[model samples]
Target chain A: MTEPPFRRVVVIGAGLMGTSVALALRRFGVEVLLEDADPGNLRVAVSLGAGVPVTPGDAPRAEQADLVVVGVPPAALGTVIADALARFPSAVVTDLGSVKAAALADTRAHAPAGAGLDRYVGGHPMAGSEQSGPLAARADLFDGRAWAVTPHADSRPDAVAAVERLARTCGALPVQLSPGEHDEAVALVSHLPQVASTVVAGLLTTAAEGHLVLAGQGLRDVTRIAGGDPDLWTQILSANAEPVARLLHEAADNLHRVAHTLEKRDAAEAGLADLRNSLERGATGVRRLPGKHGAQPEAFSAVPVLLPDQPGELARLFADVGAAGVNIEDVRIDHSPNTPAGLVELWVHQDTVPALLEALAHHGWDVHG
Target chain B: MTEPPFRRVVVIGAGLMGTSVALALRRFGVEVLLEDADPGNLRVAVSLGAGVPVTPGDAPRAEQADLVVVGVPPAALGTVIADALARFPSAVVTDLGSVKAAALADTRAHAPAGAGLDRYVGGHPMAGSEQSGPLAARADLFDGRAWAVTPHADSRPDAVAAVERLARTCGALPVQLSPGEHDEAVALVSHLPQVASTVVAGLLTTAAEGHLVLAGQGLRDVTRIAGGDPDLWTQILSANAEPVARLLHEAADNLHRVAHTLEKRDAAEAGLADLRNSLERGATGVRRLPGKHGAQPEAFSAVPVLLPDQPGELARLFADVGAAGVNIEDVRIDHSPNTPAGLVELWVHQDTVPALLEALAHHGWDVHG
Candidate 1:
């Protein structure tokens, strides 16, 4: 096999991210020493074949590790990172934390003077689920996802390289940025949306049950991220307080402006133009996002098909589409309760539509449009 | 095959919703005469087999239509409904519009004295796409979706029944509500989320290009609806101003509160609890949404499997799973550009997981978790 990214690595937490990292590294034949404060998490990760549990007797192995990864909770990131830097003096130390600059500041405040602070870097794999803990961890959790590597001014070049290498070894693309820039970027892309979704979902709590029965896919998509762990998000938002709070204020102001516009729209039709302009800006902003693998979203067209609510229908559908040699760029299934049939939207490059349609028709599949 | 729900139907606007209704009606062998101010849209809908074009010679057919469905832009709903009531004097009139109360009020104000106002009802199929116009029309657009059949105080019981029959005939569940209650319900479920998504997406206008490259699925989901037609949304929001504005202000207050809590978090750790509580409320609200078929979301377990980025792999995977006699409730494919592989998450009932796992392993499919 190819040489491992590192000879030996020590992971300080055995939670979802930690265990997943360990499992990914193990795939590359790296020797990983796993440790967690909770014995239960450690045992679960070990049973999953993520890594061998680190014993007190493995002090030398810990010290000799070429890389040390601290994958703890947001509240504990700095302390664990500092501890790892000091413990594995010869190794590069990195962390998995959402907020970068705060973790760096905390590390600087906690690390002992003359310790290898230059060997530290920060990382956040832009991939996770609503579910948490070791049982939810998977070796491919980071596959084809963005892994941000945020390096501070004093971070050593070799240390930054080591973190990037770790990202690649885990099947992720490392996007490099400074800690401050990383914080600002995530504030716009992650934290602000989190709060917006949270506020929208929080309002749903007051809605009558009969009203919520009218809920559709749009509301579900808008609120899905709001279902994330409260304590964890609280820690993350707190760590990135300044930037996130600024965006939240901006968003709130925009919402209030919309409300005022709607309120005035009846008296003057011109206010409708202002409302339309605001929505137009949102449409333009949505267009700015890089589509899958950086392609433009227009590169694909979605063909929705109606599928019978049965075991083998989807299998047959896929088999027919495959026989046509059409590659499905993506698939989205919309199934509501008590519906005898579900809608599956197959996204493919526009150029392949005719082939897909022919194959679908040949197989007697119900193409919606 | 079976008797049509109505002997004859006239659709007044051949846009997305209107044409979709016409197409759905055509499936039941109903005689449909479609009209549109835009010749291009009318031609396209007619070419797609949605319905026959209404020529000047077809005036008698339209006047004789048993049902008149006004599927126009939000701003035109009122005038058209009033006009349809006058034109098809003996026919029951219904409309496909998002907001209900304003449409009813508009029709009431515009209808000629002694006209058939009692024959009017309002309907909204709670299913749509960001894309618009006749080219996007589909016969199954409202299949298995909630179609709110809202009636004003003056609406005849037979009129309400006719509208609900239209909904059922289009393969949708007809939900009954008063016009005012429908507005309030949509304000919470649809309008609120639309503005929240728009406001959040609106902020992305000022984001740096590099920052936008870091965007992930969470941001995408949160902003998807913001890509909808601004003119249409502006009209929808304005027509339902009171309730939407109220909800907007509530959401804004929540956002401001979260921002304040975050700002005070560094000064006092107690502020973190407030933040956590806010997030917890969001999580609880999300849980209140009825899952597939109105079931709880937890009824299905998601099994994520890695897929190679090549034709036929998905077919092989689905074929393998189907051979195991397992029913797939839903499928979500997450594929990023430049990635050599994708992740397909198959949501199945919990009891079928073992058989799925066994089939996956036997077929050499890579299961993520």
Candidate 2:
């Protein structure tokens, strides 16, 4: 069947998401109008071809607009959406905020008494980088990513459908989720992860910072998320404090158990086992994520092969695995620092592990048990 | 200056390290003789060009071996080193165990009940992956990496020099450290990292395991070290429990504080600033890691740029940056799970950030504020 339609679209904010929505909509043959209070942002959007910039001076043109996408900051979101609704009463409205519950509550607060309310559909495109501003916007920015929509009780079926169509046009799969459920999920996946990474990174500055000089890939991986932008993350964590606080509290309780185990016992086996089990469960939770570009199915196995640490050993192993007619879903190598002569670990697909072992062993490779 | 002669090198315990040392020594035109309890391992070593594997049946050309390298498990290190000394008189011996402090202490227990113990030097190569067995042996595993030699007060200067020369011949830099100091440093840099990763991975597996599906790059990073061989790590953590425990306790304390700060805080500017500062410090700490290939100079500059999530965006960005004559030292990207959009943080020379920023800005890119 032919595509439905991508008609006149208005993206308020002209910041990262707004500009992205406008640029993405352009690919679908929709005429996009990007608006922002910041003059520089509007100019940047125009330069990036997100759309010709729009302002209150040209607000009259939205009379024929079919869709309105909100991408303003969480605090200022209500006023912007209300203004958009007041100007274009018939346009279907949705938001692209991280916190859906608070945004919905704010949107509810701004609706006029029984007027221009049915056109509003509370929505959040669960997408964005820490870096913001109009210049950071990109076409196809949400391709194959999730867009969670949480409609209000009073929202019309037509409004929700129109918003769904808009989301589809922007290359995101529309997933219906309750605002509260969405917040809790992100608290675990997004919010808790950022905070955990920060604390781990902080540990490097302890009694002897000199040891951090030898910080290897494992430490780097554990603390990678800690390098995000602080100002915007401040806004996000603040907005979702209630749920994030609950998640962190849960993590702290578990961490306390770990600390007591390590300090009181010698082996700390029981405590460490509990922690290990929990982390395995966490890893299981995360493995359910769709692969990049939404192209592959869920992956679970971690195949490991012993390797010698030589200049071309890694490259050879990968090439060896590739020649085995098996695709490596992903790979991770372990670099242990306590050997007189270095060894390496190659993690691949579990099914591929047997074949990889056979192929490499035939090549005179020294794979271990 | 001509190096002091280390002619007949004896490698005790013909396992992975022993076999690899045999191979490496052969490359240097040194006559090598290896010994292992397992006859099969010695055969494998002989087949792998690790020199003629000598067993107890044929007492190793004892007095001929100028340097005897002990390659045994940490659990048996003391006994192994002492046995080699008792069997071969006048051999400058060194053990290649993970923890030098514990190994030195254990060897001290079985030391010849007399003076002139200056022939033994404690050594460990700060390289290798988490895999054990003779099949994991490599010829050039220590190339370009640092080897820490922890010599006790009783060790002879000539013995230390000989080991340093051996490390150099193996293409490694020799860093001298006391046994206790080396153990503590490794606990922080190596052992603590693995434990932190395992603990973090445990956090992902609570409740019904749908969260595992979402284990994107962030969680992968946090838990990467978890998949390591738990048994080998157990021996290591047990040997260095004091420092690893200390570091983990410090991390747990900080995590608890961060969790507390996120609890039921008011929406005031002051409260927001505290959270922002905490995250900012995390960013700074992560940035303090050593650069690629162990660049002794740590500090590097980064330029943040936004790119469209399309095939050509990466190529376009690289072309633009390269066309400006700027050399990129490294690149780090923020992987956003919910969106195709990501932030690209490029590390370049300190002086190149401004020029790259100017070029990118001139080309209408949005660098995050």
Candidate 3:
């Protein structure tokens, strides 16, 4: 096995992010020590082979470790980083905090005079699920994901390199940004959407039962993120309050204008124009999003294939497509409740659509254009 | 072959919905006559076997048909239904208008004294795609979907039955509602979500490039409907303006409160509480949505299987799962952009999870919990 970049690493929190980091490092043949305020969490992480838990009688792992990762919640980030810095005088320290600006500020305010501020780098991995805790942790959690690293001007080049190496070793692509820039970016791409989904979905709580029966894919797609953990989101939002508030205020203004224009009979034409502009702008924005394989969004043709609602049917369909040598770009299954059949929409490159349709049809599959 | 309920069906407006309706009816051996202001659309529908086009010299098919279906836009519904009713004096007339109240009123005002208001039933099928036009029409578009029917008290029983029969014949479940109630219901469940998605997604047009790189499934799901045609959505929203405006105003207020609390440093505790309540309410609302098979959401354990991004890997995996005798409840593929591997998350019944895991592992597939 190759020599790991960090000989010994210490993880300060044994939660999902922390445990996953430890597990990833362990997969790279590095020794990892797990520490958590809650003994139960520490035990779980240790049992899962994330790392060896630091016992009370053990030597101070922080002082001996080459690197320490602070993976606690935003509220506790400052104190944890401060304690880790004071304890590990020679080790490089980094944090996996969602909001970097506040954590960096708090760490700067609390760091001891002799403690190396330059040794600290801030990281926010753009990966997570609705689930939490060590049980939800996986070694490959960060595989192929974007890990944003925010370095201060005074930060040591060696410290930044260490963090980047860690990210790369875990198969994550590191993108560098300043703390404020990181906060603003996440506020737009992540925080704003979370809040919008929650607010819109909240309306459904009081919706008439009959109205909900009419709900379709549009509502389902719009509100899927509303199922995120409320407590965790509250902490995240609070840490990034300024940027989030600014965006929310702007959204509110737009919404108010739409409602006002729509309510006025004389403004019908204006209302139509405003609504159309918003939608068109949305179309342009969504189109810019990176498609599969990190390429620009390409226009793909959808060939809908009818499949029996049975185990292995999807496998059979995929096998036939593979036999035809067609690369399926994306797939969406639209299954009606109480139906024995589903329409699996296979999105393929435009050039390959004709061949795919012919191949599937020859294989006795019902392919709908 | 079984005789279709309607011997001859006249479909006006040969667009996506109209063409799909004709196609579905044609599947049951009904003779469908297609009419559209755009001859290009009419020709395309004819080529797709959606229906036969009515030639200029031919006697108007509407006058001889047993049913006259007006599948026009909200703005054109009034004129088309009026003309169809006048031409087909002995046939039942119904319209597939997204908004029923305004169209019903318009038709009522335009109908001649001898024309029967009782023959008209307003309809809006709760099924569609982002793609429109005759080329996007599918025979099974309405299979197992809801078709909302709005009828006035003056509507004749035979007329209501005719509409219901048409919906059933097209493989849609007919749901009866008043014109006013239908508008209110769609405003909450459909129109409001569509507008919210557009406004939220519109913000991305001004977002920095680096920010969009971090966009995830949440942003994708929340903004999917924002890709809809602006002209079509404008008409849908305007026709249901009253209820949509009411809902938008309420959403704006909620957004303002959350922003205010988040902005005030002194209100951190209160802000967290408010945010949590909003998220919790959203959770409650989303929970009430019908799950697969139109039933309450079932708790399914996700079994993440690591698959190589090769042509036949999915098929092979499915074949293995089939051999294991496990029924996959649902599946979501979370593939990282540009990665050569993907994690296909297979949702299965809790009881079958262990068996599925064992079988997959035994079959040499990488299974992750």
Give the share of true interchain contacts found in each model: 0.70, 0.34, 0.61
Per-residue C-alpha lDDT of model 2 across residues B167-270, encoded as one tens digit per residue: 78777778888898888877766766666666555555553334333234565566656665555555666566567677777766666666566673574567
User: Which portions of model 2 miss their true places by more than 4 Å?
Assistant: A1-52, A55-67, A78-92, A113-175, A207-209, A266-369, B1-100, B113-149, B156-175, B183-187, B207-209, B267-270, B292-369
Best candidate, TM-score: 1
Kindly give the stretch of ten consecutive residues in candidate 1 chain A with the minimal lDDT sum: A333-342
- Ranking the candidates on lDDT from highest down gives 1, 3, 2
What are the chain A TM-scores for all the models, listed individually? 0.83, 0.76, 0.80
Candidate 1 lDDT over residue span A1-369, tens digit each: 677789999998988899899989989889999999986566557756778877889998779999999989988988888888888889999999999988998999899888889999899998877667776778899997889999888889999999999999999989998889889999999999998998888988998758887888899999999989998899899999999999999999989999999888867878988899999999999988877634567778999888764433555676689889999887655445553345678899989999999998888888895
TM-scores for every candidate against the unseen true structure: 0.83, 0.70, 0.78
Q: Judged by lDDT against the true structure, how good is candidate 1?
A: 0.86
Better of 2 and 3 by lDDT: 3
Off by over 4 Å in 3: A1-16, A19-67, A86-91, A134-145, A168-172, A292-294, A297-369, B1-7, B23-31, B47-49, B57-66, B89-91, B168-171, B292-294, B297-369
Model 2 has a DockQ score of 0.24
Q: What does candidate 2's lDDT look like per residue over A321-346, in tens digits?
A: 77888676544433345532334445
DockQ ranking from best candidate downward: 1, 3, 2
Q: Compare the candidates by DockQ and give the number of the best one.
A: 1
- TM-score, chain A, candidate 3: 0.80
- What DockQ does each candidate score versus the true complex, computed on alpha carbons? 0.32, 0.24, 0.29
